[model samples]
Target: MNKVAIITGGGSGIGQATALRLAEEKVNIVVVDVNEKGGNETVELVKKLGVDSIFVKADVSKQEEVKNYVKKAVEKFKKVDYFFNNAGISGSGKFYLDTSLEEIDQIVGINLMGALYGARYVAECMLKSGGGSIVNTASSAGVIGQDSVVTYSATKHGIIGLTKSLVAEYAKDGLRVNAIAPGPTETPMVREFYAANPEMKENATGGIPQKRLGTPEEVAELVTFLLTSKAQYINGEVVRIDGGFTNTK
Candidate 1:
């Protein structure tokens, strides 16, 4: 049978790229995102690749919404062979003290809590059906410290913790969990962030050893490998696709 994969934040950027990559492998896809337009667009694109696809609109931060998406995926696909727990947002670049409380809550709610909720429900379904693989989206800031994105960095750090801990508890049960740390990827979200904070963009590009941002397609490749049997032995690991950006730090 063809495999089924669920990708949260599947509307754009790394999520969309990963959806297309997996579709190329003939895997049926379930695209979940709050943006209905992008999610539906992805579903249509995946269908064009000659595989089944569906779109689930959801705000990952809400537990009920997360559950609904998982339910929808199971209802349509029967089993979730893979999950890309990749929904997140980069806050308005600001120093922690200068950042508003509302912003902090929103960041934590979506980035950290959303990821937690996804793993919770998806893993349960995967365990019941058999073994499955999951790849969480972490950031370069997650593995290391950075300025002006303290909240975003913290949530990413939590993601790493979630990845490792899940493996420790469930690897024996046939679930593999891992995280990817991308450095300043040129995704829509990153572009919007840099547009609002242009100086930070220049700084990010200059700091990276490659002197450039990473691409979503490149990150998607990593995620696909990790989520598939090609990386069956890899779990509880944080793979950094930062072009030596984190290495220099």
Candidate 2:
């Protein structure tokens, strides 16, 4: 049987790239996102690769919607071999004291809680199906400190914690849980930030040791490996994909 994967945020960025990459490997993809147009587009791309694909519209913050995503994936594919809990938002990118509670709540709800929801639901399904792997989309902000993005950093840190906890909870059941922390990635969220403050982009890129932004495909490659047998021993870890940005000055 072909392996099956359910990817949240499969509408764009790392999630979208991962969907196509996995499909090319003969894995069935369930692309879940709140954006119907982008989600459908991703499914179409996956289908073009000659693999089965379905688009699931879900707001990861809503338990009912999140549950529905898992239900559909199970009903249609019978089992889940992999899960990419990649849905997230950049929050308001504000300072700690200056940031409002509303922005903090929004960031926590989507970035942190959204991932937990997917992890809990997908891990259970994987247990029933024998075993599987799960990758959470965290940020380099999770590993290191960032003065400007207080709430965003906090939420990503929470994701890292979730990844480790779930790995412990499910490892004995043949389930693997891990997280990828990417630094200065080239995604829609990054593009929007650069467009709004062009100078900030230059400063941010210059700070990185690579002196450039990472691509979604580059990050997706690492995540794809984590979900494969080659990485069966890997779990409860946050792999950094930041091109030395976090390690270097």
Candidate 3:
């Protein structure tokens, strides 16, 4: 059977990489993003890989938009077999006390609430279809206390909780939920964040055992495995692909 996947944040970085990786396996894709250009670009790329694909432009922080993306995926593909609840944003890297309410709201709105909305709506579709898998994007900050990312860390930690708790409620019903906690990944989001905080880039690299940031391709590989039957028994796990960044901490 041809698998179907809905990837939020699919316009770039890890979400884009995972969409392409899954497309290679002939999986139909629904690329969801607020950026129309990037989302359509991903759809074209997936088509070149010879798989059915479509783009749904959406701002995931809004519950209605999140539901619409899921609806569009089902309308296009008939069923959603995998969901990458990966849309998120990092704050201005200010100290928690120094951060503004607007920044806090934006971070929580996209990172935490967005993931929650995606999982709720997507899981409903999966349950109706009899089964499915979901992969959420967490961060090393989610697992361990990190400096200068208090709000981002809070949201990710919530992601880990969301993953395990969802499995606790739905695993027996053929639903699988897992999260990935990546560290200092080399993506546009991270690049922009690091560029704004030049000292952070050097500090992060110095702390990482690998001495370099991870690539989206690497995270995509891990996502592909967890979303497929190869990881049937790996439900509710938060696998960290942080190059030992969290290991030493």
Q: Give per-model TM-scores.
A: 0.99, 0.97, 0.99
Candidates arranged by lDDT, highest first:
1, 3, 2
lDDT of 1 by residue, 132-230 (tens): 999999999999999999999999999999999999999999999999999999899999999999999999999999888999999999999999999
Clashes of each: 0, 0, 0
lDDT per model, in order? Answer: 0.96, 0.89, 0.95
- Candidate order (TM-score): 1, 3, 2
lDDT of 1 at 44: 97
RMSD of each: 0.5, 1.1, 0.6
Which of 1 and 2 is ahead in TM-score?
1
Q: Point out the worst 10-residue segment of candidate 2 by lDDT.
A: 90-99
Q: What local lDDT score does residue 128 receive in model 2, on the 0 to 100 scale?
A: 86
Output the lDDT of residue 128, model 1: 98
Q: What is the lDDT of residue 177 in candidate 1?
A: 99
